[model samples]
Target: MTTYNLARYPERLAVVQLGPGSEVPSWAESSSVFSITATSTETSIICASRSVPAKTRHHRPYTAFAVVPDEGSADFDIASGVTGVLVALLTPLADAGVSVFALSTFGTDWILVHESDADRAEEAWRRSGHTVAPATPA
Candidate 1:
């Protein structure tokens, strides 16, 4: 597996599940990094936990990490694509029994896990020869 640096984002996040075709909520705009995915079954939003409304159907307290790209290069999206990148990265965490929530942008890969497992996840990445950096708050 190719070793990559993982940078932690300092925010407790929530994954909200809304009915299909739901519009992206205004609250999500405040997040430094958030994603909205709509599928036939549901529309899911991953945003800062503090932004979610009280009645929202959501899961919370997730800590996030982003794959650090090589300096002067965005080649993080190699021929194999982000899926391949995530597969390589997720293996270590999975082996350690850490549940993860994953997302991707046009060229970046993200990894999220319950904050309770943050330390374990970092250790797993470190054991696999990846550098897990300290959280950088936005």
Candidate 2:
């Protein structure tokens, strides 16, 4: 597999869950990197650069890494038919002993690591021959 370029989002992110019938929260829209997934049973929102308010009734917060390629438009596409792409991208982190939580949409994937592991994770990706840069504005 070819080496992939990556950008690290400056914001700290959280993954939150709300009831299926609940309205989208106002904060979600303002997030730098936001993704919403809804199903009959529940809704999951990934909010970057901000944390869901403690008062908001939701699942526990999970810190995110919010990585993507450096050269594409915000909605960069990853070929679904490609094999081992994710494995190649994540192997470095695994070798560095950093665990991750991953979320993927049609166009790209976002890998979430604990807030405490962010620095090490970034370093690991860099060491693995991947270029890691600061994320560009949306």
Candidate 3:
């Protein structure tokens, strides 16, 4: 088994909505960013940021927010974070009856949990041998 150091940074997980006629805010727009396919019904968007965007992408229709740490670092979790260590992380959450929206960059992994499950999920990861910090509000 390999050990990993996880750094929980100060960040928030928020939801954004974009309706048929709505456009996303400039600040919210980024190439690495992803949005669920647009639908007539409300779509859920999970955003991780230090502060709430001034303008939310219009009519997200549905939104789910979580306490996202600024950023969490896990070493050798994947093939240089280019692949999907996140898939492995989320698999456990799913097995434990938790749903998560996960993202990863070249350096770290971010997991967005339902606000209700934040604490539970945090503890779960810690007990599973991953270093994790308590989620903090920003």
Prediction RMSDs, each to the true structure = 2.2, 3.5, 7.3
Candidate 3 per-residue lDDT over residues 1-138, each given as its tens digit: 333344443334466665664555445532223444456765545445434455755322121322232345335346445344555466556767877666554445556666667667656666666566543433
Q: Report, for every candidate in turn, its global Cα lDDT versus the true structure.
A: 0.85, 0.69, 0.50
RMSD of 1: 2.2
For candidate 2, write residues 19-97 as lDDT tens digits. 9977887877445557788899998887753557887654433455444644645434543355565787789889888
Per-candidate clashes come to 0, 0, 8
Model 1, 11-130: lDDT tens digits are 899999999999988887446568888999999998889878889899988999998887775556566443457777899999999999988776678899999999999999999999
Q: Rank the candidates by TM-score, best first.
A: 1, 2, 3
lDDT of 3: 0.50
**RMSD, candidate 2, Å:** 3.5
Best by lDDT: 1
The TM-score leader among the candidates is 1
